[model samples]
Target: MAAEQTSSVVLVAVDDTVLAQLVQAATTDALADEVTPPLTAGRAWTADRVAWLREFHRVRRAGLAGPTGEATWAVVVDELIVGSVRLKHTDEHGVLDMGIWLTRGARGRGVGRTATAAALRQAASLGASGVRADTTVTNTGAMAVLRRLGFHLTLSDDGQDVRALLLLDPEGTAACEVTSEPS
Candidate 1:
C-alpha cells in the first residue's frame, strides 16, 4: 500500500526491495546510535549490526495483519528514502505502539510529523483503538508531533522519559487532522 504524500513525505510499504534502501539509509544517513542498539563497539555500524538490522525488519515485513501483527514502512521524501515508521500490536487489545526514526538530514523538517500521522491512520485502519509512543525528553521533536496530534503525554518521575497516548475516535477522524500546536 502507498501512503499519499503529506508535506512531500510518503510512506512506502517495506518489502525486500525497499528493505535494502532502508538499510542503506540507516547505515549512511543515520547514526547507529539512533536506529539500533549499540551491539557493536562505540556506535560503529559493523557487519553484525547491519545483519541485525536486516533481520529486525525481516520478521515484521508482513505488514499489519501478518503473524507478528506489525507493519513497517520506509519513509520516503522526494523519491529518496529518509527514514522509517512502524506500528506494532501492544499487549493491550486494540492498542498499538508506534515508532519513527529519521536520518540526520530529515530531522527538524516536518517529515516526522507527516509520517507519524500516516502511521496513526494506518493503525486506525487496522481497527486499533489507540496508539502509544515512548521517547526521551531530549526528543523534543517527537514529543511536539505527538502533542500536535492530540496525544496525552506523561513524563516519568525522573523526567528522563516521556510517554504519549492517543485514543482514536470511533471513526478514526482523530488521525485525519493535527492541531497547529499543543494547547
Candidate 2:
C-alpha cells in the first residue's frame, strides 16, 4: 500500500524492491543519531551498520502480521527514496506506536508532517484509537512535527525525552483521504 499526503510525498510499503532504496537513502542522508536503537548514535555509517540496517527491514517486512507487529514504509519524493515511516502494534490495545525520519535534505519541509499524517490514517484504518511517538528533548524538529500533527506532548521528568500522543476519533475516521496506488 502507498499513502500520499501530497504529490511530493508518498509512503510505499517496504518490499524487496523498495528495501534497497531505503537503505541507500539512509546511508546518504541520515545519521546514526537519528535512527533507532541497535545502531550506534554517531556520525559514521560503517559496513556493519549498513548490513544491520538492511537486515532490520528484511526481518520486519511482514508488517502487521510479522513477529514484530510493525509495518514500515519507504518515504518517496519525486520518485526517489528519501526517508521512512512506521507503525507498530503496541501492548496497549487499540494503540499504535509511530516513527519517522527524513533525509537531511528533506528536513524542515512539511514532508515529515505529511508522512506522519499518512501514518496516523493508516493506524486508524487498522483500528487504532491513538498513535504514540517518542523523541529526545533535543530533537526539536520531531517535537514540532508531532505537535503540529495534533499530538499531545509531555516532557520526561529528566528533560531528556518527549512523548507525543494523538487520539483518533472514536469512530476511527481517517484524518484525510490517501489515494491508493497499485502494488
Using TM-score, give the best candidate's number. Answer: 1
**What lDDT, from 0 to 1, does candidate 1 have?**
0.85
Runs off by more than 4 Å, candidate 2: 1-7, 36-42, 174-183
What lDDT would each prediction earn against the true structure?
Answer: 0.85, 0.80
TM-score of 1: 0.89
52-146 per-residue lDDT for model 1 (tens digits): 87888898887767888887889998889998988998999898999999999888877788788888888888888999999999988889888
Off by over 4 Å in 1: 1-7, 178-183
Per-residue lDDT of model 2, residues 127-151, tens digit only: 8999999999888888877776678
Q: For every model shown, what is its TM-score relative to the native structure?
A: 0.89, 0.87
